[model samples]
Every structure is written in structure tokens, then in C-alpha cells.
Target: MSGSQALKADALDFAGDTATYALSLFVIGASLRTRALASLIKGASLAAIAIAVLGMTVLRVMNGAPPEAATMGVVGFLALSANVASVLILLRWRDGDSNVRSVWLCSRNDAIGNVGVIVAGGVVALTGTAWPDLLVAALLAGLFLKSASAITLQALRELNTTGASHATPVESSS
Candidate 1:
């Protein structure tokens, strides 16, 4: 991937995460069903991001060019630091319901992806090629997809449980 393309993809990632986190905040105080719905939305958003990154990476591979290694390394480090802070903040709530878990997953995945990008930057710097960037992008896309799948599944289960509980008849005593 080219330097500019990587930067653009990273920016989109940040924007998507920010929007999803904001959505979570809005639904935090709602019912379990609502929070599960928020998680569903977040999962869909993450899947979309994964698809978008995959597409971009494939195109970058087809038309290969070297990324700016120094820039990539610096930006990746900055993103990594931000993700670390987010992960730490969300860690306490990692075991929460689907909505909170989605937030934690997003932050955790981004932190891992940032490390991949930093490694890619170092590889590109040493090799003077774009393959490392492409590989990192592809791997990050995979990570996003995996996280999305998990969040989606958990949300569906929670929703199903909520629905099942509602469907059960309550017993009464005389």
C-alpha cells in the first residue's frame, strides 16, 4: 500500500471506531435489547470496515508502491498509544454485556493492528517495498472480521436470551 492510502485507511478506521463508541454511549442506559441492538450495529460497522480495508489492500497489491516507512512508523506508534489508552479504560468493563464487550474488542483489535502496522513500517523501511504494508492491512482486516464475528454472535445470543425470557410465562402463587 502507498503511504497515503494506508493513512486514509487508518483515518477511516479511527472514524468508524469513534462513531461506534459514540453510538454505544447513546445506548448504554437503555434496555438489554437496546444495548444488544447497539452491539449489532457496531458489529456490522466493523465488518464493513474489514471489507473496505481488504478491498484497499488488494488494490494496493495489484498496483504496488512503496509506503513512507518513517511516516508509517510514526503514525502507527501514535495510533498504538491511543489504542492502549482506550484499551486500559475499557478493560474494567470487558466482561460487561455485548455493548461494552464490543467496545473493548474494538479497542483491543485496534491496538493489535497498530502493532502490525508498526512492524510493517519497520519491514518496509528495511526492504523498501510495499508488501509489508499490504500484508499488515490484510491481517488487520482479518482481525476486524474476527472481532466482528464474535461480537455479532454474542449480541445475537443476548438478544435471543432476552426474547426467550419475555416469552416465558410467569408463575403465580395463591
Candidate 2:
């Protein structure tokens, strides 16, 4: 591929990833406002797992003799599944706190990552090259890591705030 072509491809991948991430964030925020956070996260987590599994099956069937497709498929599925499961498990608490919020963020981010993987698979199946698939997989991994870290930090902040609020006793001037 020419330099310009490579750059264009990279730009497209980044744009797609960003769009998916933004959509997921919007959905999550909307869910938080309109529905219970716990339920939203749980439902998203389940959906993500299902999507990952479906992607894997598609890849397996499409992946012919070359091992690259199969390998990428497995990695994509595992990464997505693991990320979703981790977030769900971490946010098992019903008391909507920083920890739970953080987990929800992670789940939301992973859902985007899952979409990226599926897109990458489609690109690979069409182009029959490993580079696009690899690029997307790597990008997905980075997104997951970045989102997970942010979620963790946010959770800590929520925890601290909750603690402070609970620690302060109500002042009554009788």
C-alpha cells in the first residue's frame, strides 16, 4: 500500500473507533438518566458477550485455510468477552457508587471495542490482508485499556466523595 493509502486507512479506522466510542458513551449516559445504571450495565455486558461470540463464529466460518483470520477472531472474541465480564463482575454491587459507575464505563467502552473488532474482521474478509485486521485489534485493545483506567479513576473519585458525604454529620441548630 502507498503511504497515502496507509494513512487514509489509519484515519478511517480511527474515525470509526471514535464514532463507536462516542455512541456508546451517549447511550450509557442516556441509560443512566432514564434507567438504572446497574441494569444498563448488566444488559450491555450481556449484549457485548453475545456480539463477541457471534463475531467469533463468523470469523471461524469465514476464515479458510489461513490461520491469521482464525487467530485474529479468537483474540478479538477473548479480549471483548474478558473486558465485558470483568466490568460486570466488578459492578455487582447494587449501591450505585464510584465503583459501579467505573465498571459501567468499562462495559460501555468494551462494547465499542467489540464493534471495532467486528469491523476489522469485515475489512480483513474483504481485503484478505492481515494488516487491517491487526491494526483494528490493536486499536481495540488500546481503547479497552484507556477506558478501563479512566473508569477506575472515576470510581475512586466517586468512592471518596461518597465517603466524605457520609462522614459529615448533619448540623442541627435547635
Candidate 3:
């Protein structure tokens, strides 16, 4: 309810992260190929979100008011704090296969995105314009797209190397 497009974008990123974790759970007992496929799906989903956020940013730029700066600042700081904690916790496992690495990337993204949100909030507070908010949102979308591309490329590489032996492996432990 802050009217901040930046915060809205961050919220979407958090939602995407949650979904990624859910997908991770589904592949916990699966093999490399299955995990890679899950990562690919997650990456594709993130790409879709980025495109949608960009479209939203464009519309907001055309006709949007400044958000509540105070609210944005407070929430952004809180988000950043939480994300940083997650980042620290996930740092050790950041370098792994596509699926495992995607987890760390998504967690890292929240902290980086929050910094932008906080900066946008301060700029909006000073200028009383939504331009900063919209800009940050768009930039976050670009970040999302970049992360998605990384995940997708790594996943494709893993799939290629693993061959077509288990393209559609069942995830059941038994």
C-alpha cells in the first residue's frame, strides 16, 4: 500500500524466490538432469516475471504518482536486513550446479534489489516524483532477466552434458 513500484517489484522477486524454493523441494531426491530441468523451469518463470515488471514499469512511468517514501524506506530496510541474513546463510552453497546455484542467486537478488528500493525511496522523497521508483523497478527487472539467463544457460549446459538418458526422470524417492 506504499504506492511504490519498487517495493512491488521487490515483492514479486520474493514471490519468485518462494516458488524457486518450492521447486527445489520437489527435486530434492532427484538426479542432476531432473534438478537441471527444474532450474530451467524456474529461470523461464523468472524471465516471464521480468517482462511483466518491465511492462508495469513503462505504464507507471507514463502515469504514476510518487509513493509514500517513509513507508518505502522502512520496508526496504527491513527487507534488506532479512535478505542479507539469508545471503549469509546461503553463501557457502552458492557455487554448485545450476539448480543449487540458482537458490543462492535468488537469495542474493533480494538483498541487491532492496538496496535499489531504498535508494529509490530516498530519491522519491527528495524529488516527490515516481521517476526514481520506476527506474529502480525497471532495473530490478533487468536484474531478474540477467539472473534468469544465467540459470537457463547453466541448465542447458548441464542437460547437454548429461545427454538424453533421463530427460524426464520421475522425482519420487522410490
Candidate 4:
């Protein structure tokens, strides 16, 4: 790829990664408002992992080789951690509310994405090519975008129903 192409690719990757982190805040924030403590903690953890991955990927791109590989190794581990934690947390959620289910689905999607990241990292290490790394980064961003949209929509729905009650109000006999 030419210098401009490489730069564009990097820009896209960073933007996506940043958006992923930003969405994590929403997840964590929504979980807090809903009083889902476990989900909150998990969201926080995932956010941290995402930041680490972003940092590492940037460092790898700029630095090169062994260091890049090392960072990719860390990304792989963190990806696994994020996935496992998300799955476990989602499993504990009892309510089927759309908001909660949205969160659960995000976790489920992320877990799958994490596996892709791991594979991409391994491929990069084996082949010493940028494609694998870039592919994974793009895939992660896609996953983030998908989850963020779902969560935001669900949260809006929840907020819109603020005054609405599932149960009927009792009528006064006056």
C-alpha cells in the first residue's frame, strides 16, 4: 500500500477503536442506571481491554516487528479476557428486558469478535503481514458499531417508556 493508503487505513482503524471504547462507556453507564452491578464491572473491564488493544496496535504499527508481535500477543490475551468475562456476566442476567437483552447480545457478539482477533494475531505472527492485523481491527470495529447501535436503540426505548407501567393502574371507585 502507498503511504496515503496506509495512513487512511490507520485512521479508519483508530476511529473504529476509539468508537468502540466510547460505546463501552455507554454500556457501563446504562448498566449502572439499571442497577446491574456485574454488567457495570464487566463493561469497565472491557473498556480497559479495548484501550490497551488500541494502544498496542498503534505502537505496533509505528514501531515494527518483535515489539509489534509482542503487543499483538497482549491484544490476543486481552481479547480472550474480554470475551470470557462478557459471556459470564451475560449468563447471569435474569431479566429479558430489551435493554438487558441488547447488552447480552453485545457481549455475545464481542465474544465471537475476540476469537477473530486472536486468529488474526496468530496469522500476523506467522506470516509477518499487515493484512491479518488490519482485518481483525476492522472486524472489531464492525462488532463495536453493531453493538453500539443495538444498545443505544434499546436504551432509547427504555427511556421513552419512563412513565409507562407494565401493570394496569387501579381505578378508583369514587
Clashing residue pair totals per candidate (backbone < 3 A): 0, 0, 0, 0
Clashing pairs in model 4, backbone N/Cα/C closer than 3 A: none
TM-score of every prediction relative to native: 0.92, 0.40, 0.92, 0.50
Please give, for residues 63-84, the per-residue lDDT of candidate 1 as tens digits: 7888888888888899999999
lDDT of 3 by residue, 1-174 (tens): 999888999999899899999998889679888999999999998999899899888888878889999999999999999999999998998988888899999999899999999999999999999999999999999999999999999999999978866578769987
Tens digits of lDDT, candidate 4, 1-174: 221212222334334445444544565545434523333333344344445455555655674443154455555467658667867977875255444554565556555665665566567668877666655654554554555455555555654564354557889999
Root-mean-square deviation (CA) per prediction: 2.8, 12.8, 6.2, 8.8
TM-score winner, 1 or 4: 1
Give the TM-score (vs. native) of candidate 2. 0.40
Please list the C-alpha lDDT of all candidates, in the order they appear.
Answer: 0.85, 0.46, 0.92, 0.51
Inter-residue clash pairs, candidate 1: none
lDDT comparison, 2 vs 3, better candidate: 3
Off by over 4 Å in 2: 1-96, 162-174
Give the range where candidate 2 is weakest over 10 consecutive residues by summed lDDT. Answer: 1-10
- What shift in Å separates residue 129 of candidate 3 from its native position after superposition? 0.8
Candidate 4 clash total? 0
Angstrom error at residue 136, model 1: 0.4
